[model samples]
Target: MISPRAPRADRRPVVRSHHGRSFTDDYEWLRDKSSPDVVAHLEAENEWTAHETSHLAPLADAIFDEIKSRTLETDLSVPVRKGDHWYFTRTVEGSSYGVFCRAPVASPDDWVPPAVDPAQTLPGEEVLLDANVEAEGHDFFSLGTFDVSPDGRSLLWGVDTEGDERYTLRIVDLASRAVSDVDVIPNTAAGAMFSPDGAFVFYCTVDDAWRPDTVWRHAVGSSSGADVTVFTEPDDRFWVGVGRTRSRKYIVVEVGSKITSEVHLLDAADPMGEFAVVWPRVEGVEYDVEHVVLAGEDRLLITHNDGAENFEVVDVAAADPRGLRDVVVPASTDTRIDGVDAFAGHVVVSYRRDALTRVGILPLSGGIAAGGVLRVGEIVGYGALTELEFDEPLFDVGVSSNPEWTQPTLRLGFTSFVTPSTVLSVDVATRETTVLKRMPVLGGYRSEDYAQARDWATAADGTRVPISLVWKPGAVDESAPAPTLLYGYGSYEASMDPSFSIARLSLLDRGILFAIAHVRGGGELGRHWYDDGKTLTKRNTFTDFVAVGEHLVASGRSRPDGLVAEGRSAGGLLVGAAVNLAPDLFAGVLAGVPFVDALTSILDPELPLTVIEWDEWGDPLHDPAVYDYMSSYSPYENVRSDVGYPPILAVTSLNDTRVLYVEPAKWVAKLREVGAPALLKIEMQAGHGGVSGRYDAWRERAFEYAWVIDTATRGARDDLESSAPVAPTLDA
Candidate 1:
């Protein structure tokens, strides 16, 4: 069979000048996505990609089937009690989306959620929203906000049909099951919630750059033109978000940048009232607010990084937020206190320690009961804080789904590399844990067959970076290095924790290993880790990933010729830079929606979310030093033709606003210029996240994984030939 010719983009060189420096961009024409020529080029690229990987169709199907078979197709999520109803979602065997439903509460004292059966609906079950039905006739559909009103009579929901991050919010009357014509809001951001009385809906709107910069409040029965602007952030660096406190006592509006934040609160009873600032904005200090009652008085719990690298909790009077305060949970160097969720009986503290997410419960003194009455044996001070311990040495656990302020049980979610997602309910008074639901794995999976472990890599600057390793116990070892996929993402202080993936089973079952490189830009160790890997120190993120790949190969856990590097989004940037730093360390590279053209993106403030990103990456437009530094390690700028680079696959969506499609398109074009066998797949109907439906997403992952597997075993499979006939060319 003859190999198809690669699609070559025409060179339309455009000179870009910044900080007394000039650069020529050959593929800048791709930036104009609306141009017919650009669309044709993208379509040609997709056609070439499909033709190149057509041999992996059978493997891709097998992998997708494995993922579907291992998953319980028809299942119901554990019901969660909120207000007067127990709400849950169900997924039918053939459906692409979930159906949200709720059942009436049995009694006022009924706190235990009703058991839901996948085969049948519970008694008195009311369907709130059927996403599958709503998604009909649309190629891409995303449900943004699914907030039910406090009275349970009204529902506020939002949907994005175009995958552009802008949503259309609408209210539906539960009794009549009719969408309100008067309350239709278009071009809204992702989150929106109904006011405490369910008469008002608070939502956010994005600016031209796609940043949520304004918060608005709309009357339930009013038109969009009559919606009042609650608050707006003039600074492009800050984004605004609106939500109510878990206690349902105050409406909260938060304005935050990458490094700083300020919160505003208003009495929930007043729909047209002024919101008071909890604390004035401070540079480099980030804090989150949670309403709680202590000593029979209203107080706000603040988890802040003010003068503390790792956050600390402070208790202050809610009536006078900036007044005198008491340090409830003091700052610690060994732990990072992320945030706090307050309830009537207790406060759940989410923190990170020993490179793992952990949760602790702190009972409030003089706590109020669900009936709005004070407990009889309440005290003034707080009870001892105790951690919700788990036996897993490496796992990710956090508080989840306990929306009620006076609920007795705290819902927590726990998962690890081998453990399926498990939801648990912990009694606030007795510290007793009850497993509410453990996601079923239909393909007879055993945890004992797989193993998870931690490893450390020494960076060039003597910094120790952590690496999370997972594989089949008997299949992967140092004595016989297996085909390995090393993943990394080190940006925005996001910590990539270990979680079980049914799709990953296809790899491990085939004697392949998977690993995560917790590099410096991530919050795995603490804020300090992220601090050392951003702005001027951004090169540390790339060097750290290269070090992990070197460590894996040197330690005999992976062969130099069988290692595949993979990352998505910011992590995609990681592998991109790593390959430039050390081209021979891996056999293949997979970058999904990668920020490869970092310098180019950051230099332009008009791009989507670019102004808000100045804190994560320095202000390259204004700072000459930053521009110079970023130019040194930016993946696109540093692509070298001299090195024997590995085979590369870049996956991006046409409508992705975060990192525009042109970044990868330009990067792949440059790679082809160097004679590298690079494939670019563009999803014309998707956003930053490739496909919407689960099955479509699974197929996308399978295609990428098949490429990884084929590249990793290229040495052994070189003799195999494709018996299949050539496919027809795609129309441009």
Candidate 2:
């Protein structure tokens, strides 16, 4: 493995013009000295370079080659079945293309090909989708959940190119073995359900700003048919999107930005018509709506967070447009509900209490005053709900930790770091799950010795910010220093949880400590936590992350010289600010696909993602105070040559649309010119995500961890030598 290049020992620290001044004073002086026009010109040039390099056609091809070479030994995709037979997909070598239903895992631990004949078992053998599978190409492909129609005549799959947020809907005619590409829409297709009559398909679309736009109905066999917009925003200030119910009679629409929301109900059959606002926005409250199901005509079971105490499920009948009465599940103040799934006469409600989440079942006929709740099982993590068949005897529930469901008999498949993926059958009534086939695990690894730790740090403002650490046991010492890597993405109410990982294990086993700072501007601690770290309060997130680092050092878990910070996209903003505020705290910084040019990024509302992000970062142009605050800490605008700074490795993709590759490119150029030790690496074949294939991803991570370890270890070695005590030895 290639180690990071160390700084020269003879390179004495340069004494600049400003010395002995506070960081604030140094910042002001640096800003006054740099010409604004020069900064703008550099930014423009960087943007041009990003655009030109991104259009190079060979980039994606090269990336695909890298992905294939690394992941070829492993079976990355698994075969799944909705009907009698099985189907699978896999990418070919030296190509960015994949073939479907070519390989099938007959049983667990069976590495050799099955004795069964392939011609009889395989369905529509190996079809080509994308000929050129470059990560940066416009036609890059992604494999989503397969939705087979009730009669098994057609199958619907979603494809996204370069994580564009928008997806192209495709349909495969099972009978003819032909594929047809549908209209492109903004929102990703989470669930594609065919109408009972099979005349149209219902899917959701999000706007360019990343807000849910409307649920659309597309007629089959028509290229230019009128698209019925089922859900739409009630006002320009708020965004609206709809979710499907099991019965297909009620469509739930949620409206609001980050701080507030209202749940509305509309007849699924006639969704284009005006909807009856079910839950009105409550003042001074921030909440979310989910698990909306239709119990009967004009009656619905709705789960909502009113910001009072916790989320609760209310059984309400839409008798009056403005009034709704609780029926089975009453509103509660202490217990929080996560999800609700209605089947037969029982409603399965998922709730969280005392940091533990579980599912409970309750019968609908029982009144709210007497309905009994029966605890089912502990929820290891949030799982997706799939409708097996319309009005079938049983429906399938996809959950982690249930391995039996991966078998061919169960017909459902799931993927994780340790688990390749397996199909399974689940009995809803008995809650019995069986594995069909275990997808082969790739790479030489196991997930047994890794662990996750949740801790808190007291911020400068006396607020407690939650931080999650994941690593192998004995990776770090409380009394000795070690290479510590801290990661954070504190923006947009995005929660960074302690999830399973295989690639991360590569770092942990190598004696590196990886941690995630769950600071404000995230929904980890609920609404209040997110509210405290967004807009003008965004600075709180930076301070909170710094406090976590300080806690780690003060507690003897790690030293400042052993620390390296990493963040991406919006999190990139956090890394830039944290480094500027306390350069001495980190030995190396990795800002990958970062948005360092915050002020300029927000200035152009016409950009693909700026308008929606305004709700999170605040509109600096509209508010002069916001502009002043943002300008004060904006990474590109805050660079100073008078102050010493840590070495940085800035990584970016030429085709990233969300953060834009130009942001990091411009920041790196500015920092380098200003005498900061920074290196820029542009992945010619990737987009926002540095790499696509599993093996390629692991290699990228390896490079990152190696850089961090070398920097931190080298710093420790230097410190030890400088502080060594003088000793006298007898001559021999």
Candidate 3:
């Protein structure tokens, strides 16, 4: 066992922030001094990994081991449910696999894993379905999203090998208990949807650049010989990503760059042929095509965004693909379209206006404006509405009394920070709602126990960045300082919304305050927010995070030494940069599967994920300006050997395809050799996600919280002393 508090004299000296100058300014100055010729040469040398034994590798490994040993105990996989029963697959007693299922629970206390008999094999418990099962010497499995046929006679699933995202489609006959491989294009199987006619299957696949490209067709019961390439993308610059419409013959492909999108229609029979462009691209603006559905036999309902406003719903009549016309449902900027579900006679539209999401129904025959909007429920957060299928008997039983009796109702699920997920079935006719499922709260937890608030912090450049704070009622005050954890991810246009988590509740129950920094690089405030946090403006994310930390301490919400910063992936980069830029602001840091080597990772176009990420980070190799900008703050390059930084736990996975293990490995090693007290934990079997199963995920959370608690209360030095062994020499 390794201890945490051993003397570390060789730790690199910390680089101090210059007085009267921001870190970003200092970085700009550093970039200006690099010779143009040397910069060009460095840009040309895009090799991500040159030397393997840099001083960082060993220390990273040690830290990874400590975190892994402390945090991971159980395998945490997603739960799959059907009817009255729910099933979860996990590795039991080491390498052996099993499926655990039991009666459905209305609340958390009622939930329990089914008991298994060692001597007897139960139905649906034989071979566990996994995503990475084909990998060597590992019991890893890809639990691909699966769907049962309408008749419930077969199960269709997609599987991936190791980190190779390309999926292999497979089906198993329920009665025969035999698995059959489906004919799918090599590297072309993303989401699989069973056709309404049930004669063929439709699935999408990605191209070499990782952009969605084609949707293929495969006849039922046919092997490799019967598979057909249905729809192929028109060009490399534009990819075809498919969404099913109500009519089985029609599928919508959202095609365009990150800044814009157009919808296209393809004949289900000959999908590979040239598509009829249903919606043409709008110039000089960024738009997203969404909620595409068949409105009627000759009309389609589509949601689109034009540069000046949020998304709006529009109706386009089915015509020659080259001559489609806008029929109805005129666009408006005041109401932002959130969701849509189209049926034969009616279409349900959910939109957000003035912070409230309202649901409305429009009849194809009677224009959308004529059909008065019906209010459903106001929610702080809204997820895209989806339909859930129930057995014939169950569907019929709820027909009369169910508010959704106007038509076969579609269940819409919604949630918020305080509200657990709730499923509601809405009748397309009467617009009535029926509660189906509500996430059960544990005995001690209450929605009113904590309060959620949002505020803005001005960054060093005077940019207003949004921050969400959550703390127990009365726990935060001037006299009593609360331990705080500030989280953020400022890249990839991903939004960090408020949602309930049991693990998070565990922290709140312990009087810990949690805040999420909705920095500029995210989609929380839409496109403009994301634009400011990526590429040349990437440093804004870290600065915004630091500003939020300062606000929390300065506003009397939390103490400086009691604050801990946490983030994963790109956000992990946020965590690393903040700790390095302002170490005294945070007591501890948690960086998981971090993209710390930003410059080196982006420079190499040959790596699996690099080419696809150019749009987000900019092509540093071909552009000198980007190279200099990225290099200035690239976590690995900016590591200073002279500064004393806060203690950090850098978590990563050896098998992660997105952020390679070498990143954390190298970072930890370098930091340790320079005499910084850092820890690293590498999951041997997992990928980008630290763990695969639910139990394992919970244990990992427990370990992380334990570290945070120990650091905030018992003190980092005390915990380090108890865990680390005393050493005279500082050789990592």
Candidate 4:
């Protein structure tokens, strides 16, 4: 591989004034993505990235092959019973996408899912949507909405071919197997669903700021132009979404912002009727509503954080949401009550406790009949909550895919760092759990060979941050540290839970330990953990990450010279800021679509999703204090020329609406000006998630892992280059 000179971005300085502060931005011109020069520069960056890392092509290919070989190429997901059909998805060996499929239910009493074989189709199997067929000519394809009508006669599905998130929805008649061309709706948001009777399809559309603001109801056979606007949110900070209740009784319109939420419900039978507000909007108070029946009386179970930072559930009359209230699940400081799903005789509560995701079932004393009336003997109050337990010390478990209103069992998904994804069904009546399916890993994989544990790091402010560690036993330890990858994403209250990945196994096999820095701003230790990390205290997210990295080194678990920090999206922002705060802490950094230029993006209210982000990151545009605070730690704004930095690889997508591609491009440009070894890889035909296909995603991961392995190992060999361990291959 021949070395190529890095692409130099021509600087044309632009002066901007904000809150009495003047800042000169040299790479601001790159933000005009429509300009031909910008395109040429991005292309040049891509070429430079390709040539600079050309030596790792074989390693990347080997990793890709290892991932593919370890995965079950031909597989079918566990069947989820919905309506009269058992719905599932099948992936063929050679296909890049899944084929949506369904088969008739065995009987009305058949609670167990039937066996499915990937090699052969089940009897009476119907292919609802073949994504491979729809994605034939397009470079990118994303299936957003796929909801079958209650009667199984109509299918309302949405597709995004450009990866920009604007989907085109189409309804197809299952009886005739013909797509209704007249019902095609374009420029819509991500989700859509059919009315209970299949008479109309309810969906949402985005406003100019890329926020879903309007909900529309379109008749089954009517043109999109004839669609009626059901509701529109006037507040730009709030995003509106439409969904159906589990009981299929009402269509719900959920409108929410970063700090508050308000729900509206309309009887599904009344498609053209107005939606009534369940609870009016109250700033600083967030709540979600779930409909349930208690002793034959209609009730609305509301989960709210009004007075409880960790949230609590209250049951109220459906007719009068706030009239009569009964505490169902009281808020606890140690636990974060996320959501609740109601059924005929049971309710599933999803929450986070001990920094792990969990699910608990609360059984109701009464059951529903065929006509949706309670048939069992009337009881007093709700039964005791039964939390589902897992054997793994660190695992993620939650209720999933139990759509039926009268399901006797609750479907759940469980996974850990060493455990493959497992689907389970727990009988609500008996509390008995059954494993329906476990994702297959083709290579010789053993859970006992790997170890996962929890560690804590003390931050400068005396706050303890949790870390999840995974490594092969007996391979690397305290005495002699090996190459390590530390990953983190601490924003939007999103938790980085324990989950299994086949591609990660390649790195683990190569004696590289993987760990997660559960820093602040994430919803790992409850709401307060997230609250203390955002807004004015956003710097904690970065400092917490640095503390975790230092802990790894101080504990001798990771070599100081072999630690690579990786983050994506907001996590990208995390690593970017952490590097600026402690440039000598990491050997390399991998930031994917990072919001590095935070102050610049947040200062402009017109940018996509900027106004809505004011809640998470304070309004720098309006507040002078916020401008100074953001400028103090903003990655691109804080980069210093005097400090020597580790090599960095910033990956971004051209069509990413969430974080514009110019962000990483500009950040890399600034890093390069400081003589930092920085490279940018821009996906020209992708979005924030990168390429759509499974194979393409695998290739992308392989490329990134190869770079991290090479960089970490090369950095590990400081004085004695030949003494460093060679990255193990499949044949090694």
Among these predictions, the greatest lDDT belongs to: 4
Q: Write the per-residue lDDT of candidate 4 for residues 1-732, one digit (tens) a residue.
A: 666688889989999898789999999999988999999999999999998899999999999999999999999999899978999999999899999999999899887998877898888999999999999999999988999999988888999988789999999898899998899999999889999988999999998778899999998888899999999999888899999889988899999999999999998888789899988999999999998987678889899998989988888899999796777788888889999999988888888888998788777752322211111122355665767777888999987898899989889999999999999999877779899999998878899999999999999999999999998876665477778999999999999998999999988888898999999999999999999899999999999999999999888888657999999999999999999999998999999999999999998877888888999999999999999999999899999898998999999999999999999999999999999999999999989899999999999999999999998787566647677678999997
Task: Give the per-residue lDDT digits (tens) of candidate 3, residues 584-660.
Answer: 88888889899887776777665545755777887776777788788778787778787887777777765677787
Identify the runs in model 3 with alpha carbons over 4 angstroms from their true place. Answer: 1-138, 150-152, 161-163, 181-189, 205-215, 231-240, 247-249, 269-274, 280-297, 306-309, 320-339, 350-410, 428-432, 474-478, 714-732
lDDT for 600 in candidate 3 is 66
Model number with the top TM-score: 4
| Per-candidate total of colliding backbone pairs | 0, 22, 47, 0
| Model 1 CA deviation exceeding 4 Å by range | 1-3, 366-379, 716-732
So what's the TM-score on candidate 4? 0.96
Cα lDDT of model 2 by residue, 184-302, tens digit: 33345455556545566777766655545666777876662477766666344466655545545556666776556787766666745566776678743444333333433445555
lDDT of each: 0.89, 0.58, 0.59, 0.90
- In model 2, the Cα lDDT at residue 326 comes to 54
Model 1, TM vs. native:
0.96
TM-score of each: 0.96, 0.71, 0.72, 0.96
User: What's the CA RMSD for each of the models?
Assistant: 5.6, 9.6, 10.7, 4.7
